[model samples]
Target: MGPDIRTQSLTKPVTVAEYLFTRIHQLGIRSIHGLPGDFNLIALDYIPKTGLKWVGSVNELNAAYAADGYARCLGIGALITTFGVGELSALNGVAGAYSEHVPVIHIVGCPSTVSQRNGMLLHHTLGNGDFNVFSKMSSEVAVDVARLNKPSEIADQIDHALHECWVRSRPVYIMLPTDMVTKKVEGARLADLIDLNEAPNDPEREDYVVDVVLKYLHAAKSPVILVDACAIRHRVVEEVRALVAKTKIPAFVTPMGKGAVDETSPEYGGVYAGSGSQDAVRERVESADLVLSVGALKSDFNTAGFSYHTSQLNSIDFHSTHCTVRYSEYPGVTMRGVLRKVAERVDLKKLTRVESPAVKNEVKKNYEDSKTITQAWFWPRVGEYLQEGDIVVTETGTSNFGIWETRFPSGVTGVTQVFWGSIGWSVGATQGAALAAKDLGTTKRTVLFVGDGSFQLSCQEVSTMIKHGLDVTIFLIYNEGFTIERWIHGMEAEYNDIAKWKYTEVPEVFGPSPKQVKKFIIKTKEELEKLLKDKQFNAAKGLQFVELWMEKEDAPRALKLTAEMSAKHNVRLED
Candidate 1:
């Protein structure tokens, strides 16, 4: 990072690249995630100069996933890749971010304007000299795309794109041409702050929405609070928490809304995924006369194959842009203001004091206590090991479903791509979330529970984590094959099996020093318990890898139910 740009406030001129990176740094992003290509090589130099470290990934897709985790942890994240092939490679990750409502600024380095104007054949192009095709593909997923072809319009476009990304909580595309990287931009604008706060909700409309919410809330004899993924994504956790606390109603979280509500709270109920929910949780949520849903995103995975039994007429849903009171939708009303107002105005004395059952994670003894580690016992056992402020990244398959059974400590930020359902995302995300935690000057631990099969897809990113010297704890679930798939469709299919690796040897292969990497091969319940209680193991040192061996056919109870419903939904009706 070149000599501290925050105090300089350049009044004269700076390279457009400097201005861009400086603006990014000002957002408090200490790192930029991506790989360097020839087209973007020069632009990479500006990153460190603007006081941002360059966290290069093994591949563009991993970079995108890392950026997604980073964004979820720190509010804003960015990744840079060379044009055409590089950006195209990251499309799936970008699409994942879009689906989950994450704010990731994707900066793509394109061929020179001259090459585009002359239709010159480029190496990364489609071989047809159409430089715009890749950007066109990106536009489908991006909330905004700012093309930096014109020098005069560059600053405005970048600022506008950043605004949209932050406000909408979605990915934005910025096209940086090779030639324009060195061009001058007005640097005085850097003196001004990027207005990140959402535009205030309209006074009358906000009041009306709040009033409607209170009317239904006050009248309902049995009302419950249902928090979802968008509550975290839309940056309304504080507001949601306030409402939950003020109302003192029973609070529950959806599958994707793992850490949205502090599980330790007395009001906090267990994870509610329709029929997949625990008996007590399902009964509480489905029987509620009125459900106050905050920032809800009802994807199939979140709802357990659209099995949500709560009637829309009795549900009041909230979102960043809109809120729905029963069947009547209030478009353009922001949830932030409405939630806050409702929390402030609601009568605490009127709230029904329903006793919320404590959702605790205790090692189960469903089967007679045995040496072998079973899925039933392992999930809750791992949950007992979790600490407050842990960034938990669960992979798409079994790990995702198993997490529902594991209650969390307060302040844990969950990183799950259920809607996207991208395999191997947790590997890169663990790196990013740990990096983000470090960037924020917090002692928060980045804990990952990933499957062996999912780990193989982007395992190279672990090398990047060790290279950066991030202190991370990985609980690599060493099942022999795709256990979740076997539970769903194929019990004995060869396609479900993955090649086994010497998992304990991973630290030596990816990490630099034997002393820095701590590895454990845990095959039994007693061994896991012993390790979990060890003083040194609990310290959260650098690159601690613990492999828990489990039978391939076993899975969490929630997954067994979900996989069955999913299998039924997948059958093509004879039409």
Candidate 2:
């Protein structure tokens, strides 16, 4: 009957949502983290049908965070939200992902074609149009923009945005018009696109920079390696470790660059973040005959805004975009090629450090004595929980603080948004990381220790965790406010305090079941231990919440030191 009555379909027609989902699938993104808004309804309709999960987020910012987190763990994050307000809330997460060099795909729904023509005040319109905010954010973070102007551009744009994010390791925005989502498109397959161009890595400039760096390394009696965040993101940990071992030079990591070289290595001089920085490290850096800074940004925060009060002199900066042989002179080269060349020509055998037992003891003493504050208080225990293959994705406030106090756990990975300092990043990142862990067949648990304020931003993504049956546990430190901002600005309580929630109830509120997904709220150390011992609570649940009811004054010592550093440097804190 069907053969006689109906002709064979000439071609497969696809909706904009189907095209987008297919492209996202090709990008290897299996889930979409977002809250369905009025404008984004069509994309939501296609989620379940297209085999991609529509993971719910309580807030747009958190959805972005979750997407970012997922991207960090899973290779790329995809977020869907309405225009204007939704995108605005998610910007913090996208910005964080951008700074941290995580590739996140933001699929924001714009007003329909009719609304665009009218130019009237519309829902989710921020005066200058919905595109203005996202475009500005993308530009600021070195992100690529792919607008789906015509319905046909959906697949091509999504594919392009995803590819760009992988190439640059930054977030990219793909704006979807509401009208376009339900419209039909022809031959919209992202997998069919070809990337014909090669990324530029200037060889001549790299050689010149490498040659200059080798000259100093060959001549210097004491050569120190200063590592930063870029080195970590570049997956140069093995190279850094090899260099540290070959040189036998004391390696010092910038605050953002902690874990580049293992902390247990004989060469590690501890992290260089002003107050927490070892005096021995400060002195060694000051006295070094040659200083090789790899992937260092040398911003005010790392240098205490060039305060150099603790240490000074003899630094040759080798960074991502540029280099410096002298304090004032600029040299040309890309960081990776230059470092790769350094790994090739340096006197790998002769570099050795004079044993300094006293200095080592002093560094250990400093680490032990750091626990007088709330942040440091948790590190030693948290350090114990960390294992090989574990990945730590931290929120803005705690990211730096954790790095400052905690030495990189051997074999554990750390992810953060130190460059952008975006808040509400931790929880979002947790979901993505969990997905990554599962996909990679790693036994290591994905732990997210976000500040209470940050957790509230994307805490709703717990449902995604539940849906996937991921082994993700969140340690929500309920300090009840924006602790970082408070410390940085010394703001009044009104500016800092966040809304109170039954913190442990997050998993229950978002998860599939209250019994399967356990939530524990604690104020004291004893309660934490009791929950820690409860196997049923932590095991095999879709999600689990361990909330630590902390005091507003209980900021990490390193965070406090950051505030102190900000004040000393006279850097204006944003309200």
Candidate 3:
């Protein structure tokens, strides 16, 4: 059904750029995101020949963000940027990908090998002879780094970097020199798919780990499965669902793991974020005698500021590279394989099944009867507006905390940068997410909730979305400043404030024709309610922008709690 590497020509001599792009294209990268610079312009010419679309972004950082979102949806994505300045500018986005475990191939076009060898000063360089500084900086964030200087090793370097990206599910860096772009190389390696498979582990060790886990699982009267962000990053969502189904165990998800499993399943409990968790969810997970944690990521934000109370001795942790049962750890036990084995070997009849507690919907009422929009009332209302198959993108501040209160319907994908905490990620991410949804032939709308302060950082990417006529609905929360920062340390500091813009006029200013885009401003609940019911708004055709006016001091309850915890941690003295 797919391209067969065995039948492909083995002796053909293809340009190095062709080989590299062809390998990437074969890996399902339909679109590559980046801005064109002089060093990379020649390499860009080969993109079309490989049947991959060049999504020219407005800036390097936005390009990287777009690629990150695309990779999350498509499993693997690529970004091409030119030397020093371009790569450095994109580092923050790559760091976020590293933190979140997104598989993005970052290809940088550098100066010719001769230029580097002669130590010639280049415009994009640091003006000194050192060209390795940038690559060294990239090494800190990337899982693997390869600089292709010799034509002979080009295929191996590219293949290794690409394979590392797929197997580790993290961003990898590859530097392509300008002169090396078109250098002819042997195309024999193209006959076989890159070996992205995980190496086999010790069978005895895996069996011992599974037996130890089963021992605890069978002896406990109450056992709950906790699915976190790593399940999605390691490509084990199906395995997690299968395990839950086979064992009939009650399951709960962390904030980062929100959409990995079908939230609408009967065994699915709500989010578990320690103190920030819903009452019933916190009780169900924390009180369990044995907890099976699959790909759990316990970041401070995800765990309500490191407030998790679960005992490590009672928890069995399953990771991408290893598995841990109580105090014993089994290295090289792949989570996918181990989870499958556990699901197959787990006897549902011998284990006790407890019904998940009913999720409570506590609606906060405005006793003062104020007409203003509030986070408490707004987030719950958003739950009612969401439909199946919608991809929800929440920004780092208020939107992130707000969405935690809203339960997603089945087939919904929630994208956020909690661990990395990048502010402007959602704006650029929406572009790639919408494109990915279109490429997958899904009839889903991309819904983005971003703060006004965060939106300004990468707001120009909306023009890219409009250029491609993407179906995106943007809900911009206009709170007059960085409300999250204010809650954290500076309550009324001037540094926390931002310049005000006519948020509704953004689309028109960005070159979108009036009829091609829709804009709305809602200061009260009635307007928001009326807008949600509007058929044109729900269709999400073209680019839809809604500016929601709210108070600067107002924040979601969860944010308040976490902010206080963060402040306490910041002031703590060393022992």
Candidate 4:
């Protein structure tokens, strides 16, 4: 007879690395993004064994950026890096995820437990012998931090961190020491699936809040629904959309909430960014007697430097974990659940339908098909070219502002780092988004709009994109420098200038063959128009890169106004 079955079942053992990666795999993480470091080498070895693909990134920062992108597309993402140096390098990217509410598990490999107890100075350390410094720093950005020193607590710690990540939709940190990578742990815990479902809310509190919200809705003569970025981050886009659809109310998206709802909807109004908003949007939103703002983040950029005229007395705000109607606030009343309740309880017949401005008003400015490209000519045309199911990523400068003028089709996804305002984030983010889209078997193309200055910050990730055979289309805005910065503070300063590279030749230099990639340099309206209509280009096969040249001083109207506001705030007032 073989070995006794009962004995094997009682004490089956597996490495800690196996346990962690297996747990991550169960959470639907098909690929891990990071760079190789000395401390993480052993842990990296267990990646393939656990049925996960290691996406070797160009750098730790890019790895984090890619992980954020992947998380937005795949629900949750994971990244691995070594201690101090590696973790610090990726902090900004992780911070961006934290700010925007993306769920990413940041696993950092540290020195062995023995070294930590003995206080040995390691290479990645600050020579202070204390390894808790980085964890403390990470605590500020991550929702939870888990330091796995004992093998017995590893499973519980991992499960807890992951649970927080999913429930909160925020990043979490896990420090796994080198010695603990191979430690034997009970294998039976793997049999239990991690619980990611949101906990039950108090029924009495939820019902009370819903009743108050309906009272306001019933009293208002003119009301509107405003969708923002948090709706997408909190996984409540469908709820917000349902609320708008059932009520047939005029809905407008904030700058950060661009693609959260279908722009093609009949009830959709344009973007609302305070003074920078479209004439109709500004008039309608500010004039409304009541406003239902869902998952709204009133950051400087999103609100056009706090220029909104809406009064708090008439506003009802819905957040991830709470709801506030005018001055009264209700904690633990989740936006997702509240939206569902509102949708179910709302009386459509009692609600008034207001007429919004005609969509044709957006096309009032006519282009003469000029040879030289202008911001006025570029944005509207690009808007016309956007297709359904395209994932659009914009950098922090001109791209972000100009994209606001473009309307996305149904099923399109928009990705930007507005609140964090990190430059050069779109390059790495596009790579991860493309990979995620591919993994989901979606034919959607990854389209990125980045300024030349921002592209230079994280351009090396293009190599990773080519290596994975991802279908991505890059529209590199070549204006010779940081156009947005110039508009903000320094119009002619040398600090805003950047080296101009042969942007069209980047794909060829980055290791993709001519046949594998398509390149274009567009300087005129005719050229852009021709390229947009090309069947092969629209197909977005392999890697497609277009270098779009424009005047250095040209910028979107919204960006110019917002930059002026920012410049005013930056100045010191001598009272």
Q: Which 10-residue window of candidate 4 scores lowest in summed lDDT?
A: 355-364
Lowest lDDT sum, 10 consecutive residues, model 3, at 359-368
Best by lDDT: 4
**C-alpha RMSD by candidate, in order:** 3.4, 5.5, 3.8, 2.6
Total clashing pairs for each candidate:
0, 6, 0, 0
**Native RMSD of candidate 3 (Å):** 3.8
TM-score of each prediction: 0.97, 0.80, 0.96, 0.97
Question: Lowest summed lDDT over 10 consecutive residues: which window, candidate 2?
Answer: 355-364
lDDT tens digits by residue: candidate 2, 110-223: 877777767768766667544455556656764778767675455566667777777666788887878888777654244375362325457876677677777767777777
Candidate 1, position 393, lDDT: 91
lDDT of 4 by residue, 1-575 (tens): 89745335547688889989999999988899998899899999999999999999999999999999999888899999999999999999999999999999999999999999999977989898888999999999999999999877887898899999999999999999999998877778899989888875688888888999998997788899999988999889999999988988889999899998788888888889999988888999999999999999999888887789999999999998899999999988888888899999988777777865444324338475458888866777777788998999999979888887887888889998889988999999999999999877889989999999999999999989998999999999999999989999889999999997998787777778777788899888888889999999999999998999999999988999899998887895978
Better of 1 and 2 by lDDT: 1
Model 3 scores a TM of: 0.96
Error (Å) of candidate 1 at residue 318 is 0.3
lDDT of 3 by residue, 1-575 (tens): 98535324436778889999999988888899999999999999999999988999999999999999888887888999999999989999999999999999999999999999999988999878887889999999899999999877888898999999999999999999999998877787798989778876678878877788888898889999999999999899999999988887998888889898677788888888899887888888889999999898889898889989899988999999888888888878878877888898987778998888654334454223688889988887787788999999999989888887886788899988888989899898889898888777788999999999999999999988988778999999999989889999998999999999999888887798776799999999889889999988888888999999999899998899888898899899999
Report the Cα lDDT for residue 172, model 4: 99
What is candidate 1's lDDT per residue for 308-416, written digit by digit as tens?
8999999999999898999999889989999999999998777665767679885664443678888888788778888988889999988899999888988888889
